[model samples]
Target: MNIIQIDRHSGQTSSQILAKAMDLHASGDLHEAEKEYLAVIARGYRVTEILPLLAGIATINGDLQVALDRWTTFLDLKPSHLFGLMEKGALLHRLGRWQEAVVSLQAAERIDPNNPDLLLNLGIALIDAGRGHEAVTVLKRVADIRPGNPLVAHQIRRISSAIVPFWHIPMLNDQPRNDAFEEGIKQAIAAHGSTARVLDIGAGSGLLSMMAARAGAQNIVCCESVGIIAEVAKKIISANGYADQIKLVPKNSKDLMVGENLDKRADILVSEILSSDLLSESVLSTFEDAIDRLVHEEATIVPRAITALGCLIESDVLAKYAFVDEVSGFDVAAFTELAPTRLPVHGKLTSWRRLSDTHDLVHIDLRARKHEASYRQVDLPVTADGIAMGIMQWIRVDVAEGVEFSNPPDHYSDGGWLQVVHTFSRPISVKAGDQFALIAGHDRTSLILMPAG
Candidate 1:
């Protein structure tokens, strides 16, 4: 055979070019080493081995883009290179290209599914990509492989707590609320028979669905929007032996399909979507959608109506949380404009003086098929000579014909639903006979509370 010259112009063989490149790279002469490596690649000599060497050299010089290019070239020749995919993903994460990082890491994870380092990077990339719920799956794999790993456990907890609302845990412990809802479901099941299809819009922990199953209902479907919570519900439901009777759908009530998700429109509907101010969680839109699509013409809605009960109150402790005038001797009253109009206050822990008798501020008939953004002027009659802060509101649910539940400020404490302080723009001094002409209504999702001209 004729002697092979990889670089005819330099009269050097392929082995000689690679040997010089390796020596220069080892001696920390990256500039000269890269030139030799490029010559080797140009001469079509050992490109597969030289590309990774070039990439490592570029990395050493902090040339991330060039390193990434070398890695891409190397991967193009060998797409199944797991470490190449991982290195590319890590660089993308550092560059803040989160979604792309997730894509790359996921590819590596498919090859070496048991590598903790690989799975951890994938989970982190998924979280940075704003897909934390999806990250839970990856982290769970790591969790299983590396049992008792506090870091993996902590990551799972962080995502779980972030996605699940704080109110859900407390709401589950609210005996009065739970009892009322359970009683209503029992009544509905009794009326429509045990086999009637019961639908729970916000099936947190699968509580209501299991309650329906326990109350002799044969069929129940519950929907939860939070994916993590939905996973928890599946475990809880399965553990409680209601897996056959209850079908949990991981979706918002608005997204639930009538024909597919549910065999037909439900015969009974129940949901606990009310926030502190009553409408902040889009209860109106949720209920309206449930009526128009999810339920039958005369579906036995568990909470047939929701009433927002409130009273004018004055409290020094409560005012600071809302309207801040002088702070550290600075008149930053303008900051009060950005203050939250309502606060979820613990009824038992907070102190306040009622300046007016309790009144029914807004009444919602949940059975209605539709609702409009309603606002009207109202006169809130005062009973004492004190500053009018705003309204201390709570929810009163008409669960059934003879069953009802409420968390009034005075009578309710440490319940799932806390009393809300609906504050005004500023403190208004008023006499005992004074009346506040204020506008109150639902803006479809949030409550409107403001002074009327």
Candidate 2:
């Protein structure tokens, strides 16, 4: 029997060599341990067992190329080896060879599809390859595999940037938003009477039209861009016994015709199309299109209008997210580079101070026929001194009557939509009355803000 030596030159057994390698690994003598493992590998002894050990040693020694080679070698011998495949895939990912990483991870997933680690890696590899749709599928699978996982949830959100349809933004649901629209509809009916003709554009839930119907509107036309959501909205309307009072138009607001759908122009137009910062939901274009093509020249637009409100704030906690710094034995300053070119932030969870109190940013008159991209520089007076983490923003919609309603700071809670706190480049300090200049505007989808002179 050919006895394979584990100790290489010392003629020890494979088990003894592995023990030495593990001890070296434990003792932090990675380089010698790697050499010993490689010597055992050279003797053709227990390749499968020793390969991962060698790869790990190479990784600890900062020899990524060697580590990758060893892992790849191990996978070739035992393709179903889960850890080896993961190591190989991760190495490729770190090297920025995302396509190759995808291939390796897919191989791993085929062997062990239920592994959330492999699924996440596969999703990331797909994302790096710019296959966002595919990434979304895998990420969602990872989400399903590990529900409530922040990392999985985060990847799902990242993939959404590539797939969110033009209409998904406003159609998404929120309790505060629904209540605001419902209350507005009630007031509109109280003021205009129940016999008024109503049109609800971007009718996500068909809720507004139902509100109008309950408020006494004889005829209500509701339009939604998403086919599935529109179908659900219709079902909801039918379930609520308002099927006869509401007409669901499963199409974009621009597709609605005045004579065919309405039999005449509408007396009222009610919609809740405000995104986080109001304009991000494409309220300008959608409302502009509906007003120009569908709404009556003098319609009572419930959410007659909406204004984006904001304030500058600062915080150390926010800096961790929006800026670069070191932490926990690692130079994580590279993390700052990972900050989104733009991102939606929550103000309540962050630790920041007010550099400026809330002020009006931009308002879209929903009843206007056409809206041009507009901008204005505003001076926000700082009421207190604090590190400026970001701009906290929310919406104030003009519902009806002299009965104006606002989601004041104290009551402004979280849901599908909340105050978006957009972080600054660095924290800014200001004394009382220091004016923070900001340039604010909208370009169809979302509101943009930046420092202004």
lDDT of 1 at 18: 84
Tens digits of per-residue lDDT for model 1, 1-453: 898667443777878988988999899899999998998899888888999889888888888888888988999998989989999898888779999888888888889889998999899888889898989988999999999999999999998787778888889889998999899988999999987999999888999899999999988999999898899999999999999999999999999998999999999998988788888788988999998998999889988999888888899998988888888999999999999888889877898989888877788899988888898877888889998787888889999988999998886876788889989988888788888787878777877767787
**Predicted model with the maximum lDDT:** 1
After superposition on all C-alphas, the RMSD of every candidate to the true structure, in Å, is 4.4, 11.2
lDDT of 2 by residue, 263-333 (tens): 87777887776666677656777777767766667777877777888877666765666887667887887
- Please provide TM-scores, in order, for all candidate models, with all chains considered together: 0.91, 0.59
Candidate 1 regions exceeding 4 Å error are 1-18, 27-45, 327-330
lDDT (CA) per prediction: 0.88, 0.75
Q: How high a TM-score does candidate 2 get?
A: 0.59
Candidate 1 worst ten-residue window by lDDT: 3-12
Error of 2 at 330 (Å): 9.0
Question: Candidate 1, clashing residue pairs?
Answer: none
With candidate 1 superimposed using the best TM-score fit, by how many Å does residue 153's alpha carbon deviate from the native? 1.5
Model 2, position 294, has a per-residue lDDT of 69
